[model samples]
Target: MRRSGCGSARVRPVLAVAVSVLVAGALVGAGPAGAADPPDRVDNPYAGARVYVNPEWADRAAAEPGGHVVAGQPTAVWLDRIAAIEGTDEAMGLREHLDAAVAQRAELVQLTIYNLPARDCGRRAPQGELSIEEIVRYRAEFIDPIVEILAAPRYASLRIVAFVEPNSLANLVVNTGSRYTATPACEAVLARGTYLYGIGYALARLGAVPGVYPYLDISHHGELGWPDNSGPMTALLLQAATTAGSTVANVHGFVANTANYSVLREEYFRADDVVNGQPVHLSKWVDWNPFVDEVPYARHMRELLAGRGFSPEASVLVDTSRNGWGGPARPTGPATRHDLNQYVDSSRIDRRALVGNWCNQAGSGLGQRPATEPEPGIDAYVWVKPPGGSDGASGQPGLGQPYEPMCDPYYNPPRGSPYPTGALPGAPPFGEWFPAHFRQLLANAWPPL
Candidate 1:
């Protein structure tokens, strides 16, 4: 299965010239003492930078009970459709957000560039406006405008991190073949090569902007952790990086679990643990996947990318937005049971019925608050997927979002082992705020809000 999930300025005369000189010097890597460094010069864009806190998201968060605790924290601004580039009825436009970022004096801004043609092709919760044949429209109408905004002179001072199309590549890996989970939509996406073209085009155009760093999304551990899936996924990434006038140089790094709820780490159990002569990988939960959580999966994926001639400096980012499985049910230690399945289940912190269940999960909690260099290969643990945004509607269809059985808490898949979706009830459509879910996250925050 596939997982899925801006601004401006002004000035004066002499004072403006002085500000312009400072900014230009910084951009060209010729700044004097204390001037900002060029984006290429920075090893980690997040380092020593104030992450932009979108006031729009902050307002929504603050309105909820106990939401002030995380209202000020940084979350990504998602441009899911072309309309979001210009202001929508419900949200600010790309330039408006960049303008707000400038006003906030934010050193870094994150944007989820997610409007690829046939996006989320494997599922139907959040569908894109572009048809599979609309790659030109995707390039001209969607990515090109965003690239123009990002490349504009006024936003040069801000380090813009563009998460290029989460799950777009990963879907090409798992959702296209004759595998049980494959769908015709995904097959069409693969057959037409739209996802690769769209992603490569976005990366190349965005990367051309000196201030924009594009991090392609590799889906979560549950999706791409297996050897077969990870290998082909890396290959597909390289293919995309080289397609449409792009190259590996265009990729600054990659982000994993972008809106999925896979745990950042399983503190108690591991994939190699042995119980009664049976390995943990044999368990239904582990299912022979080498990774048990996102951290290892991300680090290993980085190695895979590097092995395939990606930049050795390419770092990884993990979405810690909602994978904190901290609550009374969270396991404090490994299980004492000798049975492999029992040991794996009792010791795991990811409380989802199945790792494949990507939705507004019932017991998920707020994970690690955004932090830089939290792990070896990880540049930052970020709230890329804002906490409390519904994954999809549970049952009924919403305006653009079709009803997905994966989002249904009561539905069981035909192929995967039968289990309830474990999704929270009353979820709104994807990207809509769910106040009850927000309260649940706050209450069960891992580090304790």
Candidate 2:
């Protein structure tokens, strides 16, 4: 793991500089590769060719880029961060953004309902999946809504992934009929379908069976929650693998969280010139949080299995949002105040690398990942969370609140003066970073084929 006593204060200025000229977006052709098809020149967050756009919060794209998430793929809602109430979201313009994405033709709308009482997320040293209440509520709010809508045949052509939560076996086994493309990021042609496969299928591919020494990895961790380390992540992978059956599952484990939890993050961010301007993952940015980084948490299961004489491989998915925070300190989680940030640079101690960690460098364009087969343990490392979006930002100059850091382009008060460098603006609005980074990752990291 990459280790650094660095503080967020020290990072702020660097981030400013990084967000400035260092951060740019332009779509050139993907370099050269041998794995899959040619990659997109720009760094677009929705790594796959299908583009989902919401124009309410930001300006509408004048024209949908060629293969990037264009205007015709499919449009959906942005309800994941829905507020406590339907219309009570602090950022009122969100409704507009959703509408715009829909207007842009996003076939699937994503929603993350964390407001329910069940979502208490009680403080657990290693918090597992959603609390019982959260699961119940998930059914009530999400599954139920989608099932009802699709059941009614309201939109037969309206295809969507019920809940991109880590992975829901029920969702997988219950539903079948899909397209399984070799690479998750298929442009114009990378679209395939498969039927509802189950854990059995995934297990089979990994070369296992029900009674024959169970695969002891995150996949079996019934407790890991929120996708970064446990519950949701393992659950999601199993569901996908099973569902995909012998095929690569599109599991966007929480890169941010996984990176923050692991020591690997440090190595990723330390090498600024590693990938050059090309995206490390073809999408995303970087953030380091030493405390709370979940290393071996997944491997722990492997070790446990090894203790039992199983010594099986580890299976894990990561949620790489807010993870830019890096892993936790020796014993604590991310320092809320940045004073205790124990982040690092982890380049050694190699094992199965699941996904990229903490923040990717991207801008306005479609960035693509080079064609590389998944290592024994990894299925696919994708951009689950749209990049450039602030957890909650207002999307305005000099204003970073709610999560939306700086709006795309990193606009400053002075037209020509760069941001942060020149004292001329307000805090960045919430949810603003999504578009900028989403657009950039696509433009940069796309490998040359």
lDDT of each: 0.79, 0.27
Error of 1 at 150 (Å): 0.9
Misplaced by over 4 Å in model 2 are: 1-77, 81-142, 152-159, 162-377, 392-449
Model 2, residue 184: C-alpha shift (Å): 40
Q: Report the lDDT tens digits of candidate 2 across residue range 1-449.
A: 11100011111222232222111112111322222222222212222323233232122221213223321212222343323223443332324333432343333233332222212122121112344334344445543443343332222222232223222221222122241311221111111211123222323332221111112123222123223343323344444444533322222222222112222233323322234234222221222211122333444433443343332433333332213321121122222222111221132211111222112222112222211112333322322333333322223434332222222224332222332211112212322334444333334322311
Error at 115, model 1, angstroms: 1.0
Q: In model 2, what is the error at residue 241, expressed in angstroms?
A: 15
Candidate 1: regions farther than 4 A off? 1-40, 396-401
For model 1, residues 1-449, the per-residue Cα lDDT tens digits are: 22222111222223322232222111122222223445554768887677777666666666678876777778888888888889756567889878876765667789998877777883567657787888899999999899998877777788999899888888778876877778898888888888888888888898888889899888988989999899999999999999999999999999999988899889997898788988888899888998999988888898999999899889688888888888898988888967788788889999987888888888889998888887688889888888877778787444444788877777876656477888788877777888888889888889777
What's each prediction's clash count?
5, 151
